[model samples]
Target: MEKYLMKSKAMHYVFVIIGTILMAVSINLVYEPLGMVTGGITGLAIVIKELTGFIIKGGIPLWVTNIILNIPLIICAVYILGKKLLLHTLFATLCLSAALALVPSVNILPEDYLLAAVFGGALGGVGLGMIFVASASTGGTDLLAMLIHRFKPYYSIPRILIVIDGFVVAVGAMVFGISKTLYAIIAVYITTKVSDGILEGLKFAKMAYVISDSYDEIAKAIMEKLERGVTGVYAKGMYSDKDKKMLFCVVSKKEIVDLTELVSEIDPKAFIIVSDVREVMGEGFIEYKQ
Candidate 1:
């Protein structure tokens, strides 16, 4: 238990570090320089700062506002995702906020708005992806999405997030004018794309389901040549009502082409379906059981 706890803590720190670096790069190099508002607490803060110019006395500074907004989200995470997720998320959020406040003192990128938007969005996405991999979040609207998901599991979290973010962007347009608001939308889109890319890269796995006449040979080849365990599932063809031996195995993307070629050589008419799995956990995968 002690060993596991230490390992978990170490993993959390690694995620926090990656999140911090990405957030810092996005804020300093892209979003702030370009005056592009994103779809989170940070975006809201940017608009507020641009409109008020730091003159809102007694109200929270953008930095403080960020911390405050995440509080409820963290609480929600504790309930939805569990205590371990909450702690890692808190660590990531604090570190991100601190990086934003501190890193600006040293300008690190060009002032071109387009460049800023593209790179900043990419950086922010990667950061968010790292946080997600750790089963944590940087809070904000994500917490709200999770809370909603907890009570209504059928509701799409992504759609909920988009609606909330859209509202926020509308507010930004009203406050920061149409031009800045449009740029913010662009940044948000870029951020989402980059985040997706990062997540995809980090958790790339292939799920292959094969049905062929040469089931035994194919299974043997996969197990021995590929050094991967295969599950021989008893399956029935829906249309034909014929019994079949279905071979299921998860492997890396690098092996997909080779696996396909090998299957083709053995059985030219084999039916193979390949799906991209975001994450896998267990022996010969992510080691979740341990």
Candidate 2:
């Protein structure tokens, strides 16, 4: 048991290391060269590095700037987010900083700042996703998001975070240009989307809950037309005080309309409910793996 636990932790650390390095490469190769600040402490670090380049010759390195900014946030996280998260956050931060130092800045794009923004944001998003899935974060504005989440649990941290990151990106607009600013916005949007996709996984499906008097007909129609399995859950109507077959089926979004039509044709007032399912693994969908 102890050996297994150790192995798990080791794998997690490896993943975080890889993720941080990929993120650093994206920053150095894409963001820095294009001067596209897509938000986050890393973005700010780039801005600072450029602004202070005259003072210290080459300027304060991104790794140093990143660590300096993350210090207070890390401390705040330890108090608010707990020690486990803080430990992982610290590891992620350190790994990211080391990566930034090791990975040299290279110009991948010639004149296409748009390409840089897109690629940089996508690569960074993937790295961030891997870190997040491992229960760690590349500390920066992430700490601020967590801090805000702690204060107001009701408000969505990610959405609020967009507003926060917007300011940072706006600063980039001022320093960089209107064109770069637009690309930065695009980068940030794509980054969030790709990160969300990674965190949620790729499995997408729809769930339909149907309560109808002609349960047998509806079930048969769904099986024949939709070619999907239907699970009949025994349920009782509240007002009617009568037992019935509450059918349930998981189908693709494309098939939803067909299934709904079948249900409606059978019984218009069937008390049907449909909902979006983010992930599903079963006989019909992605195979269960362990």
Candidate 3:
């Protein structure tokens, strides 16, 4: 058990490092040049740096400001959340702060705000998503969300994040001007969606439930050809007051055609309901988290 925990800790470190690097690169290389200040502690730091052009001999670096703000928030999380979470968040935030300090800012897509927003947001989102899956955050609004969720389970995490980040972005508009602020909004939206896609699994699939008289034959066909598991659920038709076999199956989006055709061929009037499944975890899909 100790060894397993050690391995998990090592993996968490890996996630923190990679995610930190990705975020640092995105922020430095892409967003900074375009002045796309998507809301966060980092974004607030950028605003402050721009506002105070040489207060302490030179303007404060983003990482320095990020750490300055995050310390109190991290302490709050330590008290509110727990030590394990605090450790992960601290590691991730420190790595991110270091990377931002050490890494040079360069403009790969110079003068193209749209391009910067697109790629920068995507890369940042990927980084954020990895950290999220590892059960840690880079502090800032993430930690704030946790603190809020602890007191009010009524408010969802996403809503809390939006409310917090939205306020920052609103303030950012004053610093970055309207044009850059608009681009920043675009970048922030893309970042949220891409990160959600990453954590949820980009390789989307479909979940289907079918009710038909020939469910047995369809199930056998699905199992044999698709090699996907099919569960038989006892279902009753409310309108007709008749009992029927309901087939619950999951398959890749590509297999939907074949499965539907097979069902149609087997039963001409099969009642089928198809729904979107953001993720799947089972014997065939991702293993359940320990």
> Could you say which candidate leads in TM-score?
3
Stretches of candidate 2 exceeding 4 Å from the true structure? 1-7, 151-157, 209-214, 221-229, 232-246, 252-274, 281-290
| Predicted candidate 3 versus true structure: per-residue lDDT over 48-122, tens digit per residue | 778777676446789989999999999878877899998889888899999999889778888888888898888
What's the count of clashing pairs in each model shown?
A: 0, 0, 0
| Model 1 stretches astray by more than 4 angstroms | 1-6, 10-14, 54-61, 67-94, 105-111, 132-139, 153-160, 177-180, 193-201, 238-241
Candidate 2 pairs with clashing backbones = none
- Please estimate how well model 1 matches the true structure, expressed as its whole-model Cα lDDT: 0.72
TM-score of each: 0.76, 0.80, 0.90
Write down the TM-score for model 1.
Answer: 0.76
Please identify model 3 stretches exceeding 4 Å from their true place.
1-7, 54-58, 151-159, 288-290
Tens-digit lDDT track for model 2 on 118-219?
A: 888889888876776676788898668767877887754445556778999999988888888898888888777777666666567899999888999999
What are the lDDT figures for the candidates, one per model? Answer: 0.72, 0.84, 0.83
Per-residue lDDT of 214 in model 1: 93
lDDT of 2 at 211: 89
Where does the lowest 10-residue lDDT sum fall in candidate 2? 1-10
